[model samples]
Target: MFARRALRAAAPAFAAGAAACGATTAWLADEADAGMFVVRPGLSASEYKPLVVGGVRQHTDGTTRVRFVMEEPDLELGAVAAAHLMAKASIDGAEVAGRVAPVSPLTAKGYFELAAAAAGDSAMSKAISSLKTGDVVQFKGPVQGFQVGRNQFKSVGILARGDGIADALQVATKLLSDPRDDTEIRLVYSVRSADQIVLRNHIDALALLHPRFKALIVADEAAPQWTGPTGPLSKPLLASILPPPTEGDSTVILVAGDVDAASGKATKARAAGVLGAMQYSPAQVRSL
Candidate 1:
């Protein structure tokens, strides 16, 4: 749901031999040759040479984690971190744009965890529903937003659900990667089923590796083997998950969810001072 602010369009710039397989007819003005990918017209079936789908893993809960590999091992992704790319996919002739959460990175490959949605009036949901293995999806970004600096905050709380965890992970990785940033982070993620916990192992590894990082996963319906808390997010859950309130304004809480959770519209839940009464909304992604 994290969309970048649109930049001013530049003159049409095409690279030499833009006839790469899966390359779309339209390009983003000046960025066509600058690591920007274009989808084929009518979402035609074609093998993207440099970028190809490597593996597709589907969880029991209908969420999918797809890996994209680059044939060129030396491809430079720029300052784009995992989970920070705003990707637009063409599905059945329709365009659906959403954030692609970075999972793991290798010299020549990357992974993204995507959620499945029930057929509804939402364009993104419909797009997610239409996705299949070997589909050619084009993405271009490192959408501009917050910049990670040294010691930006004393502690940070992240609230997310399903695919939103990728967004939270992006922020966490940025903070933790910088050893100079001593910001403690608390991640509270909500889900409907245990099978939907796609990044559990990775999250656990981060918590185990970093003393300043902690994660709490909440499930709406827990299987008998489940050990974590189970129920809708409420004050008690927030109390147990979030860090103590800070004396200064240095503490921050970043919540990621649908428009309601992000904007605190429904339940009046987030507005109840979950993380020291902090809240802000730059914009909301409207549903289809």
Candidate 2:
């Protein structure tokens, strides 16, 4: 996770690429106060250009997963990963930050999934609420976020709630996929009910296959047939899940969801997200 400022420094290059891909002399401006990207002109802001919406799925628990085909043939998923890019979506004039996840191991051409928890009356929910197959949604990104060092830590502890599990998965996927990155990962997923748990099979499969990965799910309201831990993921739960920190600062905590109440960085355009929270401190912590 690199800072957005770093992405801005490379803005000229991004602008050039966008221009080559039907963008006309688009000017990139860093809204430093907002710590976000803003295209000054040349690109039509009012235009609702279409990106092929592949499909939309609603889970039994009300979570929504939207898949879109990246129409830009030049868009490289690997490049975005290497650059640590974060993106936002604009639909029905509502804009919200979104995270990209793998739809399939062997993605077909430029297809990927966009996930939103859509839990509350937030911008994300509003934008996602109106989504339909074939609707055109605009995206602006390749923006930067927190930067974790290359093999900097030996272990990562993730505490995620609600839709934030997507963020945890994003981090875990990167570290686990890198053969050279032998970092151990532990993830604690908290949700209101069993039905609310998303991507269980995927997470479970990763845990089963990867010796370095562990996943635990806690729900506030457990169904009669459910048998996992039940309760809020309070300090005690976290203490039990997180590994003790080793010397040389080889451990860090990454948090997402409901962090605003905890006075932690929450993926601000440039600042560390929940990773900057104080309670998880002494051990480094950041929000995604």
**Most TM-score-accurate candidate:** 2
Cα deviation of 167 in candidate 2 (Å)?
1.4
lDDT (tens digit, per residue) of candidate 1 on 102-170? 544311223333444342223554465456667766655434334434476787777776666766776
Compose the digit string of candidate 2's lDDT tens values, residues 169-224: 76777667656677888998877667657677778888998999998888777689
Tell me the alpha-carbon RMSD of every candidate: 8.5, 8.4
What's the count of clashing pairs in each model shown?
Answer: 1, 12
Residue 264 miss distance in model 2 (angstroms): 14
Q: Give the runs in model 2 whose Cα sits over 4 Å from its true position.
A: 1-50, 57-64, 77-109, 116-130, 246-248, 260-283
Displacement of residue 84 (Cα, Å) in model 1 is 3.3
State model 1's lDDT: 0.53
TM-score per candidate, chains pooled: 0.61, 0.65
Q: Which stretches of candidate 1 lie over 4 Å from their true place?
A: 1-51, 57-64, 70-72, 80-83, 88-97, 105-133, 259-288
